[model samples]
Target: MTPVIELTEIERTFDADPPVRALKNVRLRVEKGEYLSIVGPSGSGKSTLLTTLGLLDRPDKGSYRLDGIETTELDDARRTALRGNRIGFVFQAFHLLAHRSAVDNVGLAELYQKGERRSRTQRAEAALQRVGLGHRTLFRPDRLSGGERQRVAIARALLGEPSLLLCDEPTGNLDKANTNAVLDLFDELRAQGVTLVVITHDEEVSMRADRRVRIDDGVLSDGSTSFQGSVLR
Candidate 1:
């Protein structure tokens, strides 16, 4: 089976005075239904990689294939469309509209997608239910707790049934209890065959993945030798 996301010799450079390289020969492959995490500190190119994977930005060089489609050369419109249809994103910030209810927020995501809007309400409700937020469907962002709000965001991301769910610091804003709640939801989603690639700097977050990869100085390395600062795999 083809990987959901594939990057080969991916290089990204910024046009600063010194022309800094944000990514260097980064190669990664995420299979269907896999849960993978990429961990790195600030200035370690995690954000750059997230943008590239989400199709929000193009790499300066190399190939990025999304579900077998070559994305690097695709036009902006095509890339946007592809990203909308194939990828779902969750961020550190919930990014929920303040005035919209959980269901409304989730339903709105489907409006931009390429399918019939029929049963949108039902689908959105189901998504909320999937994230264990069925009771909060009518609740607005401000009324919900941090973890509840994040779960609502996850419901929105899952509205498209996306081939890949790309999350960045998904649990960063929550307290320990909420963080564990959100991560438990991620674990449940993984068990149900949702493909996820989470980018985080937290060791606890990275360790939850089936496999973890570390990124530093634009280089990517396997988890076997790096978790807990020892070779434990």
Candidate 2:
């Protein structure tokens, strides 16, 4: 099977008085339809890795291939197009437009992709229904619960029909109940053959993934331990 994401010796450094190396010789592979979690504490380069994977940031040195296409050398325009078409992002913060209805928020995702306005609206509604938020289509972000708001964000991400879903702290702001709901939704998505890569500090979230990788001090490790043993301080 072809890998959805492949990174080889990825390195990223932030220029400072003393340069900060955010990623050091990172190597990772995520196969199609795989659910992989990257666990790490704050400031551990996990976010940087996600940005690189999502094509929002370029590594200082490495080879990155997305769906069999080498992305490391692509021009900014090409990269942006690939990222927009192939990647979907879910952040901890809902990042929803407070004034827009759930359906509208989702429809915004399709605005850039060429399509009839009516078709985009229809697609948005379908995505919301998929996430169990069909009834909340008219609700604004402020009126929705934290989980509901996150679902809207997820719906927006899915509106693009992306090949890879990259979530950063997807459950960071939710209560246990909502977190479980989101995790369950992720399981369902996996069952439906969606590729998922989640970056989080939560142990419970990590355990739900089919594979887990630990990152600390800008280094990566194969996290093969039990949930109890995988906690990062």
Candidate 3:
């Protein structure tokens, strides 16, 4: 079966006073419904790789195929449309609007789809309910706890019903309890067949994924040898 995400010979560079290469001919493929993790130290091209996969940025040189469609050459409009339809993103800082209610935050993602305003709101509510946050839907960001806020973000991501979910340090701000809650949510999503790609530095988070890739100066390699600083599998 064709992979959900495929990258071939990927390279990303920054033209600083002294040019910098963030990624170096990295090639990767993520199968459908798989839970994958990318872990590395800062400046290892992990973020670069995520943005490229999310269609937020284009690689300097490489071919990216999303569900078999080549996306590297698409214009901004087409890329935006593709992202709206196929990808969902969750960031470390639960990027929720401070003034918006949890339901509204999630409903915002639904605005990208073609639908009546009421329908979108209903969908968002259902998404929040699915994430076990039905009671907190009316609360604003400040009114919710960290885990609740993260769940709101996840609800927003799920609102899109995309085939792929990209999470960048999802549990970065939470304590152990909240972190486990978020991981449990991921497990639930995985059980339901949602493909996940998480970028994290936490060993516990990385271990939860079926496959982990480590980034070294932009190159993608199996992280099996580097598992929690010791070889496993």
Q: Per-residue alpha-carbon lDDT of model 2 for 1-233, expressed as tens digits? A: 67898888888999998999998888788888999999999999988998999999999998889999999989999999898889999999998988899999999987656567768888999999999999999999989999899998998898888999999999999999999999999999999889999999998899999888888867888765323222221
Instruction: Name model 1 segments beyond 4 Å from true.
Output: 223-233
What is the overall TM-score of model 3 with all chains considered together?
Answer: 0.92
Report, for every candidate in turn, its global Cα lDDT versus the true structure.
0.90, 0.88, 0.87
lDDT by residue (tens digit), candidate 1, 66-109: 99999998999999999999999999999989998999999989
- The window of 10 residues in a row where model 3 has the poorest summed lDDT is 224-233
Clashes of 1: 0
Ten-residue segment with the worst summed lDDT in candidate 1?
A: 224-233
What is the C-alpha lDDT profile of model 3 across 1-233, one tens digit per residue? 88898888788899997898887877777889999998888888888888898999999987989999899989999999999989989999999999999999999987775556768878988999988999988999999989999999999998878979999999999999999999999999998899999999787888898888888776677864422222212
TM-score versus the correct structure, for each prediction: 0.95, 0.93, 0.92
| Runs off by more than 4 Å, candidate 3 | 224-233
Query: 73, model 1: CA deviation in Å?
Result: 1.8
